[model samples]
Target: MELKTRMDGQVAVITGGAQGIGASTGRIMAELGATVVLADVNEDGANATAEAINADGGTAVGVRYDAFDKDAVRGLITDVAGRFGHLDILHNNVGGSWPDRDLQVLDIDDDTWLKIFDWNMHTTHWATTAVLPIMLEQGKGSIVNTITGGAQVGMSIQVAYGSAKGAVSSYTRYVAVQYGRRGIRCNAVNPGLILTPHAVEVMSEDFKRSLFDQITTVRAGVPDDIGYAVAFLASDAAGYINGEAITVAGGGPRSSHDAEALRVGAYGPSVPAPPADLILPDLH
Candidate 1:
């Protein structure tokens, strides 16, 4: 059989789909012919996105949801599956780090840690548990959890957030292993410094510049970078890919600190001249 990437006739539910990566993913999946459901706490925003997709000739609906509420999460899944008859994709993307509160491990408070875990880990658990039966009954489904690069690398801040996401990474694998034989596939996508609206609003120029230095690509990552990855993983194109975490951060830093030092001539004349192509464009 020819390789396939189309999502025609499939149904996808994307959490955190009001804006940013979630919204972009909804759009792409809808374009690929899936009936997309954009779920988020931002009810108006979700509806607006759904309206746009419908106007664009794609099937989509927006629903107000609180991922933190187990009952609400279950209801959302149940309603979607009941209406659609099958739920093909579940993108658990509602998660974030509170830079102001998620400080160093010792400095962080218990509430902060709990909140972070709830937002990231608990949400994934609730949604996955709620949807598994439906997917299992159908004998096929794809679940993609959104993870962070910080989970894979050491970070000076957002300790709780990183730890929570680390748990999510492990959970992704467990779900895949336990359900793969039952026609269920679980995977994760690690987004590296994606320039979403919220990211642009909260990230400082200096911070963005510093992050850009660590990225190995010509341009900083946009939501579509991740949206495309989710669409692929959700489609039959990645049928054989399960229980894997794919990093989509424009080829993240290789010895970031050392590379930055070399760029600034920290090693002086002793260091050989770098490749001309190593000089990248200034895009943040």
Candidate 2:
């Protein structure tokens, strides 16, 4: 059966929509008939994305500002509500740090930790807080956030990034539980090593290859994958799936280095595994 995803006359605001997964989501939502507002710090890139949507005969506009700014978020919510009279969806896709800067727990500094928290966790916190009032007024809405496997499994050089993203996942559930009764749904999309423009600029070919090779599917992810998931969660199609953290990874390596023995004994001996206390499991 064919599924129809018509979002005609709806209004959406997407943070970090200038490029990467956020930009792709904006384009997809606009094409599906929503009035997309591309919010980002990069004016040129934001305008370019809006222009592309316009050229495609979709409704879109650019709102340039730092998503981390509380004032900016408040103004954004007010503007979108005043213009469209209601907000149906909000996608929070900002916040990422370089691997070098994103260090392990002991190696990271206070400033770095705070910066990551503000950018990743606080972006979700403030944006969602500011938008909830408008959504409550309308009595229905969806908010999608970006997270990653690292947030749950814990990565070597992503202490700050992982910790902040974990907060996003936790907060997503909190929002859903708090507002589901009020007709709002909140969820998250955790993208793996997607080859976004920002990622390509920072990651070496060898490093990128190693990432893909590590995946069980032997393939890296792309922005469109994340975009598709965002669109689904934003649409009424996902009305029943609130407080979910949907991974966009191609079912990443089921075994970490310490769990390699489990692969060898698939149907044989029961291999010793890491204690459940060590690593967080995927939310069932």
Number of the top-ranking candidate, with lDDT as the measure = 1
TM-score of each: 0.91, 0.87
Model 2, position 200, has a per-residue lDDT of: 64
Q: Find the candidate with the highest TM-score and give its number.
A: 1
Superposition error at 269 for model 1 (Å)? 13
Superposed by TM-score, candidate 1 places the C-alpha of residue 48 at a distance from the truth, in angstroms, of 0.9
> For model 1, how does the per-residue alpha-carbon lDDT over 1-284 read when each residue is reduced to its tens digit?
65478999999999999999999999999999999999999999999999998999999999999977889988999999999899999999999878989989799999989988999999999999999999999999999999999988868899998999999999999999999999999999999878787776777767766764565566777888899999999889999999999999877854677658755767674334324233222221
Alpha-carbon deviation at 51 in model 2, angstroms: 0.2
lDDT of 1: 0.88
Please list the C-alpha lDDT of all candidates, in the order they appear. Answer: 0.88, 0.82
Instruction: Per model, state how many residue pairs clash.
Output: 0, 0
Off by over 4 Å in 2: 1-4, 258-284
Clashes of 1: 0
